[model samples]
Target: MNRIACALAASFLFASAAHAQDWRNHQERAQDRHEVRQDKRELRDDRRDVAELEAVLANFDRARSRGKEREMVAVESQLRQLLKQELVEGRAELAQDHAEIRRDNREVRSEQWDSRHGGDRRDLRDDRQDRRDDIRDARVEAASQSARKNIARELSSLMGSRRPRDLQRTRTLIIDLIQLARKEVRDTKQEAREDRRELREDRREARDNRW
Candidate 1:
């Protein structure tokens, strides 16, 4: 009975560990998606700025070709201002995009690291909890086994003097407890295995999406 309880506890711990890792991966992927969207938006804006600068330069050239000196001077001034402003804004936007890209790259690397290493501080926390559960389950199992042994010993001592029916009933009860414990342990183990499998598949999907 005690062994069964210990097995069930171990199964639960395993499931929890897998779940924590899966959740971390999900969050990392979400962040990656947001970064990608922002990068695309910035690129679109940069393209629009470049198009406007080209149009302004074209107008300045047409004014010069028409021999309109005053108009050409005005257009040239406007062109210079537009060029300077665009250059400044473009450089700033480009710098921001570069920085954002670098940040995104770092985030991807961190996510990959977690996928390979079983995920950040959460895994550490889960490991600690598993260790504590192991110790507690072990102690409980030991105590349960000891108590069962003591009960069996007392029953054996009274076996000759006690009614046959009473002895048989006590034996049956112990057997039933053992069976129940085994079933519970088996079910828990099956559930843990399923959870682990799902976690593996999820990690794979996340990796593919990132690439």
Candidate 2:
């Protein structure tokens, strides 16, 4: 009877550990999905920025052609400022993305380590990590929305001063920008798809190990 009771308790413990590991894997998969969505949003924003920049460039060209020296100079200044600001923002965002990826990777490694080491303490660590991830995700979403709003406002302001001649030039520029944006969007989507595939494979491997 004593030996039987010990075996039952051991089985229960094993099942509990397996359940915990499964839950951890599910959370990681969800996080990966969130990241893929975030990348898609960023790709859309990038396309918008490209379109706006093209519009501004078109307007500048039109102004120059019309011999409107003052307007040309003003537009040129705006273009320079916009480019500089965009460069700064782009670099900052790239850095943030890299950091987030690194952090996620660390979390994955830690989870694997804990699974190997096996203890209740790992659960507490996971809970803390989840909270941190939630906060970071919220901040990233807010920043993305803010960026989209700013880009829309700038595009609206630039479009407000459009002259009849500017329309044709703007149309041409828009076509070019659209083509470029479409290609970029396609590339981004492909990359995201590949990322998701790898994630799925990792999850499968994790599940196999759990069993």
Candidate 3:
């Protein structure tokens, strides 16, 4: 019967379409798995690159031979440039991630702000701990200077003394005072360094936040 043949043909066409759809779904699934594997591979490669960079930075300055030192310097310069580029790229990625997070948060907050007061306001807070640290550093610097002056005076007095025992005692006292002054100076220097580090970190955070 022609009707039976037509029905059979329609069923065959439908079956072919189903088979093609199944094949396409399988291909899509395989493609998704391949993409995931590739992402993992890239992530591992990036981690290895970072480790290599750190090793180069750690050992780049250790060569002692004249020729080797020059070589080391050249290598270190190149490594530094490479690391700088990597760091810049990493920073840009992090900043982009931060910007995306901020944008999402802003959208959430905007809805709430609009509901509350019809004016959407975003708050941006500036960190001033660095300024406070700078003030503390100035005070420590002044104290270190005073201690250095006292140490100098003690050393001068020690140099002028005549009696052997007195001289030895003066010398010992001067040495102790000098050590104390040096310690104070070192402490002040460390505080200043820490403050500078904190300021740099804050600036970096600010830059990252800007986007």
Candidate 4:
């Protein structure tokens, strides 16, 4: 009876341990899923940051000649913040991926060391490479999709509201026209000056002939 009781207790303890391990695995998986979601959000934000930078560059170019120094300074400040945010987010994502890669490498090393039947070590390496390639592709796809979305948003903005890009273009055309007018006025002034100088010379020659 005692032996049977002891055996039962042992079985109960083993079951409890198994349950605990299963719970831990579940929690780990949940955490991993959460991290992946956060990473994706960060990636999206990073893409937006890049798009904003491009827009800022376009605006900066337009404002450069307009003497809108205060507005330009504010925009530049915002651009710097966005750049920093992007860099920080990128570093975070890279760190997450690097940690994942390190974990995979450790697992592969352990598997290689403990394996009695080695099928193909190269296959494992290839799988790791494939995962890396997939991650890179995902990042690129995210950026591309974000860029398209930005373009759509900008187009909508232009159609729906007064866009700075359009304003800048208009301003540039006006400035160019103004410059051309100034050049024409300056040319006319030079012509008048030359005519005046020739008239004076002709009067001087006539006076000398009379003398």
Error of 4 at 89 (Å): 2.1
lDDT at position 120, candidate 3: 19
On lDDT, the stronger of 2 and 3 is 2
What residue runs in model 4 are displaced by over 4 Å at the alpha carbon? 1-36, 117-127, 130-211
TM for every model, in the order presented, reads: 0.39, 0.53, 0.33, 0.42
**Highest-scoring model, lDDT:** 2
Residue range with the least summed lDDT across 10 consecutive positions in model 4: 153-162
lDDT of 4 at 36: 48
Model 3 C-alpha lDDT per residue in residues 1-211, reported as the tens digit of each score: 9999999999997677555434533443453354345435534545555455445434433432233646555544554454344444444434433443443354344335433542212211211333344345445545544554554455445443345564456435434443543454455345435534543543443344344
List the candidate numbers ranked by TM-score, top first. 2, 4, 1, 3
Clash list (residue pairs), candidate 4: none
The global C-alpha lDDT for each of the candidates, from Candidate 1 onward, is 0.49, 0.60, 0.45, 0.48
Q: Mind giving the per-residue lDDT tens digits that candidate 1 earns over 1-211?
A: 9999999999997677566556656864564455445445544554554455455446545654575667655654554464355445444534544554454455445555565655544433433433343344334444444444454455445433334465455445434334433432443343334334434544665565355
lDDT of 2 by residue, 80-186 (tens): 56545655655565575566656556665656666576644544455455446545544554454455445535544555345655545544544443454455456
Q: Between candidates 1 and 2, which one is better according to lDDT?
A: 2
Candidate 1 — which residues are off by over 4 angstroms?
A: 1-20, 101-211
The ten-residue window of minimal lDDT in model 1 covers 183-192
TM-score of 4: 0.42
Q: Which prediction has the highest TM-score against the true structure?
A: 2
Q: In candidate 2, where is summed lDDT lowest over 10 consecutive residues?
A: 170-179
